[model samples]
Target: MDINKIHYAEITISAVSPKQYPDDGLPEVALAGRSNVGKSSFINAMVNRKKLARTSGKPGKTRTLNYFNIENELFFVDVPGYGYAKVSNAEQEKWGEMMNVYFSSRDELSLSILLVDLRHHPTELDVQMYDFLKYYNLPVLVVATKADKIKKSKRNKHINQVIQTLELATEDKVMVFSAETREGRDEVWNEILASTRNDSI
Candidate 1:
């Protein structure tokens, strides 16, 4: 895919309710991660846009499911981040319900890109999200973000740790990503293309 040829991309909707989801029938690739896991940076890097997904220093800033249309081919659905301690239990429950409804019921969802911090082991919430995707039989591609923060010599070790911690299957794909360096962008795009192709079949 030509990242340079991506001419049309924008947040079509910030959905608080499933009723507000776009009905265009385009395949959707969802971004799932804990708060401050660098999902926004990933999106911006993937699309070759600056500040398109709204990066923030604060965690849990994305409270809605943001749908971004990319060249009319597919939608990158940035789901709200999980595991922020500042949010109240009641708010977390609401977020959970919103995510559950979307993940389980949305037919357009082609794949869920699960992001985790590359420097540390996968969090309990990360594991839970991975499990939730598997429970629904959703295709997932694990992306270990912030790869630039870790040394190249230790990258493989960390990646292996993530695989082990997540208990990823042999066939499951994991990409080492760095938004700053754009290291894994091509691989991630290829996975997205393959997932969408399978979804269409």
Candidate 2:
């Protein structure tokens, strides 16, 4: 896809329930990650818009499902970041319920892009998110973000760690990404396109 052609993207809704989701029937790619994993930065980089998705210094800032309509061709669903320490138990339960309903029942959901910090191993919540996607038979692309923060020489080792720790299948693709330099942006978009195309079949 031409990155320059993505001129119509915007956040259409911040939904907490199915009734609030868009009814346009566009294929959706959901983004999942732990708190402060650079999901928003990924979205902004993908769309070539600096502030399309708000980036925050604090964790757990995104508490709802943010739907970004990309050129009206598809929707990028930004689910709330998991594994924040300060959130109340009740708030965590609500997030769990909201995510469960969307992941299990949303027919338009074509894929889920699970983002993990490239500088460290996948967190427990990251593993659980991957398992949840697999349990629901949802296609997944695991992205190790913040790649620029690590040395290029050590990147392979970190990527390998992420894969092994997550127990990713041989067929599953994992890309090292950096929102700062836009590294892996094209590859990520390609995966998104492929996933959505497969869903159309």
Candidate 3:
């Protein structure tokens, strides 16, 4: 299939309770990151469909897993990004529990894209997420978002910091991306395609 032609057809809320996932057979690629880290923008960039993922200047706006069907070939699951301010402790705890079940038991989740800000090294929350994915033995690709914000000379340094901090091996994957500039879209597609081949979704 021509990935460049891919467009977002529909986005439906899936498993608002986090207990109803892994039942859908569609291959799932999950996007995870800290709040305001540009995950929704990344999704919009990936499908070449602007505003489909509903980006907001405010953080913690998305609280549920949104599933988007792409040309009937794969599913893009937008997991709510974590660590937002002004969120109640009870709400945060609930979100944490919901995520725990999703990551641990969702059999249909094939690949997880961990989105981090390219201009800054991964934050503590980002590090925890990387460790969590590793502990689960899941396939993950670190996405350094907003690549255009950093200078060319500084990009490698930031990327190296993320790699070393996560303790990722040379073979482990990471991609630099900018949603506004539409960079790294094709590479992200390639990674998603690779995940689909494993038949986990």
User: Which runs of model 3 end up more than 4 angstroms from their true locations?
Assistant: 198-201
The sequence of per-residue lDDT tens digits that candidate 2 reaches over residues 30-63 is 9999988989989999998899998887889998
The CA lDDT at 14 in model 2 is 95
Model 3, span 1-201: residue lDDT tens? 577787445686566665555355878888899998998888878887877888888899877778888877778888878888778889888877877888888877889999999888788899998888878888899999999999889888998998988888565698999988888878878888878864221
Residue 84 error, candidate 3, Å: 0.7
lDDT to native, each model: 0.91, 0.91, 0.82
The number of residue pairs in model 2 that clash at the backbone is 0
Query: Residue 168 of candidate 3: its Cα lDDT?
Result: 82
Better of 1 and 3 by lDDT: 1
20 in model 3: Cα distance from truth in Å? 3.3
Worst-scoring 10-residue span by lDDT in model 3: 15-24
Q: For residue 77, what is the lDDT in candidate 3?
A: 86
TM per model? 0.95, 0.95, 0.92
- Candidate 1 is scored at a TM of 0.95
> How many pairs in model 1 have backbone atoms within 3 A of each other, for residues 3 or more apart or on separate chains, i.e. clashes?
0
Residue-level lDDT for 156 in candidate 2: 89
